[model samples]
Target: MLSLHANVYAHPEGAATGPRRELRGLPLPTLVGPGGGPPPFLQVLPVTFEQMQAALAELPRCDCEPDGFFLLTGHTPEGVFWRLNGHMQEYQPEDADGPSMHRIELNGECPVASLDAVLRTIGWPKAQLAFELVREGVTLIEADFREYASQPATEGEPRRPDRGASRVPAPCRGRDDAALGTSALEANASYTPWHITFGTYGTRLHGDRRPTVDLEHNEYGTPYLPRNELRRRRAEDTLTGPPVHLSAEQRRLIERLLPEICHRGGWRIHTAAAQSDHVHVICDVRSEVHGEKVRRLIKRWLSEALNEKWPDPNRLRWWAVQGSNKAIKDESYLQNAIAYVEKQRTASR
Candidate 1:
């Protein structure tokens, strides 16, 4: 079973506009075929509050109470089901008296076959879906499924909402192709891996000339900036702390700690290298685990280990907050990334 979280906004023209209604612990059931088989792929099943309530009562209960709506897509003969649990929160739009916006925070699981169908059922355009997965709140592992479009949509099928009609602003539309493209380096789904690169805190390289927070530069490649100017700026800026230089022993310690960290996280490390001021890794994680979360876990665990080993008087900073995470699209890209990390040497400058 794959776990997913989603934030869906209801369009003002098509959504409920009266006082908020609370329907906790509802079971939303999907429409079934004449023979009681699973609903056809991409079929929109209208979910009601009462059905959600009923479904909630029948399903196994956890400690947390269901605080939102539910949608059942289909059921398999093997006793498996595709379901969505959504918690509704109301927000006021820019116009004070305008129709209230409903933001549903959804969490649930389904068979992998239902992923593309569920997304298409939600009526989000492909571009918006990709952008939200990569840069939106809580990077999603399911975002990798953006490649699912390779499968043709059911022909002559009319698009419909999984629940109710809701129009959302198309934020990712009109963006460059590169921005919307899947980070997965390969077209094949099974072999995808992530290539990550991060820098130690206070480390400055001559090539690190781009402004840190520029999302546009990140979407496209960074523009040309003079190496001399970047180095000069680094010398003049007092805020950027001194560059970190790990000793031979420190590097050895990192090599030992990284594999341990990866093992604890259930991630398979393909290759990992710790340079004087930076680190590079290529690893495979659960399809549901996003790169950002994995990067954070590694940074946290290693920082803890390093701090315990060397207690500093002044707080010893370990890593830069942001890192490069590129999905390995194919075997060729994966091999190249692994080679790059393994063969990298300390910069001469």
Candidate 2:
């Protein structure tokens, strides 16, 4: 049995009862597999960010491996919500006084059936319950299952007015068809261009010298080191030699090498520019190809070509570990990326 808790909210459309009762450590029967083996029991914990962090902190450090999975569900007014599916891998407290953060590795499949059971237990009618997976989180794989129990269905056959199921309209299939597009090319299109920018070792920028960005909560949630603090740290941590800046010959070499490398790697280089301290490239890659890998490959090829030409005995690091890898979602974005890379000097000035 899996014990779960929930803080129920009033349904926007109003429920048969005023509002569903809050579940408090409610024990749910474990599912049995076809082979009569005990299937994995998942606890659906609908929590706020603060609550989730608190729950994670309360967990005691144990040598025993995780036996169950947890589904973290949360909502925002701006049509943003998260349905994170993962088991606690490790827990470590920031300090003796602070709360602990659990490092969770995301699982590919979320137990929708289990979630349905949870909703059913909470008295939400099956007909009213609807969810769609949305890809918006920083962890490219992490997605939200946006629930729409209150909304009316937009597509498919009309429901009978007399039926109990009719009280709660069918799930609204919002822009699934339109967003995916109709044609085969549109469906499997890899038209998204990548805007890659990498700096030479030891250059300060908007987001450098900070704690690594949490891929799960990439934008707002992550803490970044202040620019002044970064500059101070850089000043304090001086190197034996000067910072690695690209020479005129090196920049020229990069310009000559990028197109050939892109062609060989089955990528289309729309625009590329090599600067004294950094490099930028706007390239079209396959739909499945990761932008990070593309940037790494560009840096690797450039570094190798440069190393062969000007073999430095000191073995200096050519490129910084961090770089920008933005995807151009549309034609306008692609054009903008191309222009940005092409006129890199003018933009910098």
Candidate 3:
């Protein structure tokens, strides 16, 4: 049976069940295969930026061996950030600039369990990174081929079959409607586009990038900490801060991948923007698709696609080990997200 330790609160006098009770647990169960087979050995490789680029290039010709898959992660630099407090604090343009983009350490025990779960917790910066890696990985495996049409015969007399036999040439039908009767096909005469545009991401101006390190705080509360203590706490949290300027090449890559990702997840992208360090997307929940699944889909797809030509799985290694799924149940939150995405212009603007 699957079980773990439960924390039961006791009275100050030592009697049980007086104040609080919390539940915690050890590893629950080895939920792997149905009945239980051998413990699955998941092969994990941490790829670097140059390595990832190489992997992406080589991916086109390489064969994907059975029982093998990989995860991609990327990271930003660390630093201190000062907030803009209305007009009282002068917001300098230089403050908008931070550090150059680079990969973070991915070894040791990952804080989260899986790549998909980590994305949901931290939001889109990590998701964008994972998406970039997965796209390259995917490209390595499959070519993005455009649909081609057959040309009419250059010169030929339309051959007539033996009419006495009673066989007739069939009427042309849409690929999907070929099996339908002529009467049914006539009832639905409108032509529908073969592919749908569920979402998009791009910058209007050339080289426009977006800033990261957004700050939001509760306005209702004023903490009573002494001046020195407050500064000390903030300093402690300053390590591994946000990234500064991101390359235009990185931004463009994300723009191409987001829409493709939405299509793969069976979800519609209401709006999307590829910023310097983070990406913003306003998407509707596909009844069948959840956030965590979307995160994984993007990560794996981008990594594989990029790695195809680059042959380096580690170029864009910013994702956390695990990503989480978040549900947007309210319309207001969706609106705000969309607005935010629309306003993201790089410092140059």
Model 2 stretches astray by more than 4 angstroms: 1-191, 205-225, 230-241, 345-349
Ranking according to lDDT, highest score first: 1, 2, 3
Give TM per candidate.
0.41, 0.40, 0.31
For model 1 the TM-score comes to 0.41
Residue-wise C-alpha lDDT for candidate 3, range 1-349, written one tens digit per residue: 1111110010011111111111122111211211232111121113322343334334322221111122223322333211100000011123334221122212111112222232222232222221101111110000100000011112331233222321111211101112221222233333211111111111111112321111121011222223354444454353232223335665566667777775654456666655554455555543433343345445445545544544432233332223223355556765665666667633223
Better candidate by lDDT, 1 or 3: 1
Error of 3 at 61 (Å): 23
Better of 1 and 3 by TM-score: 1
In candidate 3, which residue ranges exceed 4 Å CA deviation?
Answer: 1-246, 309-318, 322-325, 345-349
Q: Any idea what lDDT model 3 has?
A: 0.29
Least accurate 10 contiguous residues by lDDT in model 1: 131-140
TM-score of 2: 0.40
Task: Please tell me which model should have the higher TM-score, number 2 or number 3.
Answer: 2
